[model samples]
Target: MRYLPLEEITEDMCLARPIFNGDGRVLLSNGVKLSKNYVSRLKEMGYQNLYVYRVGEEISDFSTPISDQTMREAIHGVKDAFGKAAQRQQLNIRDVNEIVSYILDEILTNPNVLYNLMDIKNHDNYYYHHSVNVCIISTLIAKEMGLAREKVKDLTTGALLHDLGMVCVDPRILSQPRKLTEDEMATVREHTNYGFQLLRSERNLSILVAHTAYQHHERMDGSGYPKGLVGEDIHLFGRIVAVADSYETMTSGRVYRKAMWSHEAIRQLRESAPEKYDPDVVAAMERSIAFYPVGSVVVLNTHEEAVVVDVNAKKITIQFSSGPRVNALMDLEPDSEIKIEERLS
Candidate 1:
């Protein structure tokens, strides 16, 4: 499905998927016919765009970054570097450094576009999709933290390589859909050190960037692995990545569970246990995340459905097929009669 802006949502476009509100309730059934109220409600809610579920490639590639091909090329290009980095008996920091450099080049050259491209990382190719999601999560966090453009590039690079050490591990462990045993989890935790050691051999890469790959999984509460250093000791880049990593991991679709809606996902991060992540970072990440991101379908609590068309200075205003735009995305306090239903996959 393609996302349609609220202004662009017409009676003509069809609903290919069911839509729901944050409460896990269905608001619109699939195949429901469209109406004028759909547009009105969506606009009232401030959802800028609507997703057209069943579309051709022509529509799918209609985005700003226009870098799917470029990204695919880069993804494969870096795969070779990762292979080289992984094969050495001793860590080869050069590979990690090159990998990070390439990623930074991509982000710096096209920040605004790729920056926005994060919203659409759900396409095929999990590896590339993973890269895109990491970029989105990291960029959002960095931007909200008020980092300068150059620093944004550095964080983006760190995020792209944060999992480089994982590439050295067995694919079976990384791709497993179920929970891992303690032993398996231990092996899984090796990525941090392995990544750091590998990057240690490289040249000119900043310690901050290298540390991101190694320490991102390390938590603030010291519940993390590979030398579970607690808060403050964890590098700033590492800390930034921790929130970004979890945000991407929990919110995105997995073999085990459906991807949670962005709003719900933020709520989970806010309410979750151990206080493993920094609370401030969580809040920044939430504001940066596109809860009702442009071009996703949503249903209201009023039994009305809309497609998010635009992001206002505040709320996500949805363009509905039958309802009016709600006043605020933050005021998610279920309007007894109005609410968002579902996030289109």
Candidate 2:
């Protein structure tokens, strides 16, 4: 299967994976042959990419960090909880905890897998999807940093609701396709305080979890918002979440800006670390994510095009867009001279 942009997808391509709605229902099942109408409708629905099988290619399951069913359920839970919170109702803490536990369990079951952020995105459910992505990334980072199991669970929970304050902000500002004014930007930044208050008010939740919402925007050099606490002043959970949150947000598409590629997003994070983000937390994140996810098309230093087949082994299948195509598998080891020059998509 190949991951291609929606604009690049053509008619008669078989969908390699299922497309689910915001409510966890399958909108298009796997192996469905896409027609002109299917592609146009998907684009109209704001889908950016699709996983399609190539000609004569065998269908194989493309695994995610967590299963699609679990991801859909988590997103649904987040949407439900945030909608209730937006209505000034108390958040269902038990439901939120269960969602976090399920995500943690899935990650813990295979802690060594490099997380691939391949989930499809839609503008309508951006916040909910972003929340779940942050939670999964934060959980992986926490485990890689060797946090206690219980602490990992707490971090996962906090990461899941880090953006709860967004519900209090004006939706017009968030969905607008233009730059925000100074006042509007300030209003957006206030979500930290708003989320902190909401989370802190829950008696059954830990104060540290609330801090994750409050301090995730705080920078290592005291340049962040809500509060300008310097390094070590921010709680460990906050620091961990700060990195995860930034990575997830940068790699996700928004109404105002296009999404950054995973490798470029990681580069920005690494470049800003020790000043804008925690160096140790960034390091942990670097180890947990796959810079080049499976099914990604990349250019080799030798000027050949190939598709990534296995992220763990850095294995790729050589192919081309034109001329005689060759199918060969090669591992890109650390010591190997053959290196990935750039990601095409």
Candidate 3:
């Protein structure tokens, strides 16, 4: 299966994976044959791309660390909690902690899961979806860095609540299709302080979690907002969440811009490491994310196109252009010349 732009879709193309609604209900199920009508409907609903099966393309299960049920639950939980935060009302701290704990449990259970951010997003639920995605990516990065169990939990909790301040921002500013004005940009940047104040009010919560919301926007070069903290001054949780936030924001499409490819986002992170972002954190994230995720169609150096079926320790399993499958390291030793040339959209 391969990701195709909506305009590229034709009749009789089958969906490789199910698309879910904001409520996590199946909008369209896998293996469903598509028609022009179906494509038009999805386009009307704001879907720009889809995963469809190509002839002779091998289907692979794209596993995530958490289940869809858990994802929906977390999204709902964030929506409720963040709404309360925006109002300056006391949050159900216990409930929020429990939800974070549950997510941590799932990540810990699937310690080696190669994270793929494939959650369906809509305009109304972007903030909720983004928070959950950032939390997952941050936790996986912490795991990759070999952080202690307790530290991992703290980082995960902090990551989940990092964007709490966005709730206070005006929807009009966020939804603006054009670039924000200087004044509007300043107001948008105040979310960090807003979120920090809200989270810091909960005495039962860790101060680090509040700091996560506060310092996530800070840059290592003292160019970040609010405090403009320099390297080593930024808390570990803050740095981790910052990297996750950057990645999720880049990959998750917004009204103002198209979503970037995974490899491109990773490359941006790598290039900015130790300057705009923490080098160690960027490295951890790079190791955690799949460069060429499952179902992605890639052209090899040999001029053959294939779909990545699975990624393993030292190599990836791919269904070659010839229709046969092979488990070979696409970038090393014997298969050194067979590098991935480009990832198809």
Candidate 4:
């Protein structure tokens, strides 16, 4: 199975895996043969890419740190939680805790797996999807940093609800496809304080969680919003969530722009490290996500094309060429000249 841009999809291909809506409903089933009409409709609906297999090609098993069952439940839980928060109603802290526990367990079990943020998004529920993706990425980074399990859980909770203030913003403004005026930008920026207030008001929640929502937008150089705090003045949880939130948002498609490739996003984070984001946190994030994720096609230094089947130790497992004679390259010699030259979606 390979990921292809919408323009590359043809009637000769088939869906290698199912696509789901934000509510967990399957929009397209696995193994469905593609047609010109289906491709056009998907494009009309804002789909950027798809996982496809050429006719007669084998479908590989897709795996992630979390299970499908847990993902569905978490999505439903986040949707409900967001709705109540938007209405200023009392939130069920116990329910939220249970959801966080499930996610933490999954991350702990697959400590080595790179978190994939590609499949969890859809146009209908951007907020909920973004929330879950942030939580997943943040938890992975926390674990990579060797934080205590308690700290991991705390970070997970903070990441899950980091964008709570967006609920108070006008949906029209939040989804606006054009640049915002200064007044409109100010209104949007208030989400940090709005979220901090809501989280702080809950007696059952920790003050640290409130700070997470507060400082996730802060920068290391005092250029961030709300408080514009500088350096270590920001809480560690906040710093961690800031990296996760930024990486997730950069790699995700938004109303104003297309999603970035993982390598490009990582490069941006590295470039801003120590000045904007904490250098350590940026390094942890890079270690926690695959630069060449599974199913990505690439051109190699050997002038051959390959598909990435797995990733380990900053290197990828590849199957070269597109012919039926498949050979897996598990590891490169220390002096091997072969390297990934480019990523082709």
Candidate of highest lDDT = 2
Writing each residue's lDDT as its tens digit, candidate 4 over 164-270 gives 98889988887676679899999999999999999999888888888998999999999998999999999988999999899888887754687888899999999
2 versus 3: better TM-score goes to: 2
Clash totals for all candidate models: 54, 0, 0, 0
Give each model's whole-structure lDDT: 0.58, 0.82, 0.79, 0.81
Q: Could you tell which candidate, 1 or 3, scores higher by lDDT?
A: 3
Tens-digit lDDT string for candidate 2 (1-345):
678888788775888878877676778998888888898998887787888876566644435678887888998998987888798888888988888888988887774576774667777777888888899999989888988778888789889999999999999988776779999999999999999998898888988888888998999999998889999999888999899999988877655677788889899999998999999999999888888877688888777887776564233333443224546666676778878898898
C-alpha lDDT of residue 57 in model 4: 77
Clashing pairs in 3: none
Residue 149 displacement in candidate 4 (angstroms): 0.8
TM-score of each: 0.67, 0.92, 0.89, 0.92
| 154 Cα displacement, candidate 2 (Å) | 1.2
TM-score of 4: 0.92
Clashing pairs in 2: none
- Tens-digit per-residue lDDT, 232-319, candidate 1: 8987777778877777776555445655656777788788533687777877776666666555667666776665544532444455
After TM-score superposition, the amount by which residue 250's alpha carbon in candidate 4 deviates from its true location, in angstroms, is 1.3
